[model samples]
Target: MTNHRTGAAEQIAMRGLLGTLNDELGSPLAPEWERAFWAVPRHAFLPETVWLGDDLTTYARGTAPQTWLSTVYADAPLVTQINDGKDPGDGERWPSSSASAPSIVFRMLDLLRVHAGHRVLEIGTGTGWNAGLLAHRLGAENVTTIEVDPSLAIHAALALKHAGLEPRVISGDGAAGFPAGVPYDRIIATCSVRQVPRAWLEQTAPAGVILTPWETPWLCYGLLRLTVDGTGVASGWFSPHASFMLMRNQRTDLRIYRDVVRDEHVPAQSVTLLSPWAVTGDDWAAQFAVGLQTRTVWHTWHDNPGVDGVASRLWLAATDATSWAAVDWDGRTDERFTVWEYGPRRLWAEVEAAYAWWRQVGSPGPDRFGLTVAPHGQHTPWLDSPDQPVPSTG
Candidate 1:
């Protein structure tokens, strides 16, 4: 898969993509990165077959050349592999690796602030396009990327080679940052993480930056950038715009009926003015604020419970499956809804309190939040400043 712009058509496509990226980023790419962008075409790094959109529809370059080329230039993520590269059979399909959206790719690259001589360690080299771009800008010797899946790593390495770039692609777990590449000036994780790995902090140089997408059990959003001191601690603030898959090692595989609720359990019923939709609603800010506090709970919506007078129910359960709550919405009213609580801990009350706190504080967005990872790997999430720590459930 040699990389080249065939003729006028390919050059036109490249120009269109550049314009789209510039508009999305709200600024033109730095001259250096702009050169790298043209030097390494994104289509060269993608597989012959790529999945597009949420349904994972297949698009093959060999067959649908025009459609595939157009889709490649779109400002959207293309799923490269699903179910960790295994045939899901009849099971549900989930994205394991992808070529991240161009907008997000450039956004993160801009945030990195990589200089000419900076050594970078990138975790999760899914498609190798990012590594190729970085190598083209900062030289191949200054960048190293790791991928957990061997096949993906091999494919990415081959892709990088075809694109005339080499960045020392390593096949290993990203949680354990590569020891040989110690004191990296910039450490970035393409996948989101629940907890910052201790190795990442130890491997970074003094005043280096570690940028990774952040995830909590309650909500998976936000990009956290922490600046590491020469000491073991690192602290930074969160920014908007991220929805990457969780790191393979940090996934929680708990089902609502299979793992949480029991048939014999009798839940205590009550009433509350707080609506379930208010906390777990479409508002990402509210969900993000609640998630920072209720770190262990996940949710499910039961649209048709089959119970008469019960139009819908929102189920909330702790990650350990020890505590659970359900909020029932009748067809009539929004002022008060029925709440059910059944475990040692009251999950609904915690959510209500978390929501109240967020509202009391003017409902800050992701950017206003920050985290401090201590020397011993203790993460304390704060709002605005370190002294004002947000309430935690766990």
Candidate 2:
């Protein structure tokens, strides 16, 4: 089947997709963005094969054209590459690259607030669809996008070419922002990062916006929109419910029982009444608060841990492979929960303190907290204002 969207049926499908996206996103799309949406056809940028869900069922256009079309138009992320494009036929490997959900794509672009003639630098040129949109909106010559994966980059370049867009597409480390395109008015990253690279800040024009997904080991990712000051500082607050795949270079491999502990290790036992759910619940605000305090810890939940009664285990491990902790909760018990800690850092203790701080601050959400990236590469998380650092749990 031809990849080009030239047939009458394809045009109709594109229009229907636009209508659906408009309705789902609430009302008419932003005027400028709408034009770009119409100009850049998403179907043109998709790979012949894509993956869906944990099972990673391969959806190939040749076998199921209708399914392919539906998936392309849907408001969901499409995994374009898995296990860094080396998973072969196995679906067990982690997903590495994807076309971000359309809603988030537009949301991040809206946050960018690009003006006419403003130059833009986009990190992670996954499918080139995003670059095509930005190029359509603010002239192809004004947009520059870099992808780390060479194969993905080449594919994106070809796709952009097919779509009649000519934004600069380069293959290199996205963490090292393309300096040739320095002084950009806006910089956006499709991937998440643990630290906002110094190169990104240096490349951005003063007063320019740098938007990316910032993640802490303590919690999930948050969208950070920071404005660069000429004096070598960037400060911004996080938006709630924002997350993305971590940047390749910044991905961590810390895990408990596998990398952090040994069979001979012994943990101190303690019992506390602090309800497990309060800290490890669906409340993102609580999670973000805890993350800010415990900077380099990863956690996981194991439910029904082979116990007689229904019980849940919350495991915490340091990225450095130095400390680990576990909190076990049985549904019947409300007065106390079992906690085990090994290594120097008491993970549960830090979590309890962090949660307490979160409550003391009235359980503020991500928007209430801000981050200031200093010139000397120090990241100081603050509450409400830049000068007031959120009290440390350390």
Candidate 3:
């Protein structure tokens, strides 16, 4: 199996992918970016064995060259690593890293508004494809990329070298950022973060852009693009919906049944008309609002837990695992749901207030919501404008 793409067929596939990306983006791909895309072909960075789709099924380039080539050239993400570099054979395989969908990749490139001779620092050098593109666009010496995983860093470095683009690739924690690259003209993170790292604020040049995917324990969605003021504070709006893997340094692993729920613990019981489905799924706007209001809260749903009458249940827990709540839907009624809350915080009640505030404030989407992070790392989420701070449920 050839590790590289060749011949006229590969060129046609690349052009097809660009057309698909253009249609999805609602604009023809930027001329400069189009050139970068062609030069840094995505398939070259991909491992011979790739994972595809939601289930992360296997697609080997050697066994199925045509299929692998088509999948690689599609406007979609290809899972490059799973289970944090573990084999995960016959076990639960969750995406640890992936090549981002082409549309969003191009979208973020445009969002950065990069200019000639701009020095860019990229966090999360997953496959080095992005770093190669940045190097090609802004020159290799002007781009620096950091990957937390040493193996990934090595692979990405090799791939970048293979592409004839040599950017500075370092293996280090992204949260600390690269102090040596202080006053970076632009800083971009290929990963999502629950909170904006203060180091990133410290390193960005005045009026420079810091673009990253955003996550709240409640949901994973939206990109945050902050503008530096050189005063240690950076304020940014949540734009375009996209979910990237959380930064490796900022990830939390907790299982509700094993780590949170306990049989001996008793919870306060209550009834609510608010359907669990209202804020849990599809209504990303509501979820984003709730996430902002309760910064540390996260959720998961269990369907048909074999708990007799309950058809489904939504479990909510603080990221610290200090407090927890559960809302049960009995299948028959959509209007009424039973709620249980334990620990110091009335988690469900906090949710109700957050939902109410979102409703009262015209139910703005992610784009209208923004965050103002002070130098000390306190996040003040706001509505429409920073002056209108959203109330927090203590």
Task: Judging by lDDT against the true structure, name the best candidate.
Answer: 1
Question: What's each prediction's TM-score?
Answer: 0.97, 0.94, 0.98
For candidate 1, report its TM-score. Answer: 0.97
Clashing pairs in 1: none
- For each candidate, the alpha-carbon lDDT, in order, equals 0.91, 0.86, 0.89
Output the lDDT of residue 77, model 3.
84
RMSD of each: 1.5, 2.0, 1.3
lDDT of 1 by residue, 230-305 (tens): 7879999999887889999999999888999999888898899998889877899999999999988888899979
Residue-level lDDT of model 3, residues 268-290, one tens digit each, is: 99999988788887899999999
Model 3 regions more than 4 Å off: 1-3
Candidate structures ordered by lDDT, highest first:
1, 3, 2
Instruction: Give the Å error, residue 315, model 3.
Output: 0.7
Candidate 2 lDDT over residue span 1-394, tens digit each: 2456746766777778778767766766798898888788888899999987877778998899889888887878889998898845534567889888887888788889999899999999999999999999999999999999999999999999988899999999998999997789999999988888988888889999999987888776689999999987999988874678899998887666578879988999998778777877788888888998888877888888786654888888888888888888787777788989999989889889888888987999998888989777788899999988987665
Model 2: pairs clashing at backbone N, Cα or C within 3 Å: none
**Segments of candidate 1 deviating more than 4 angstroms:** 1-6
Q: Top model by TM-score, which number?
A: 3
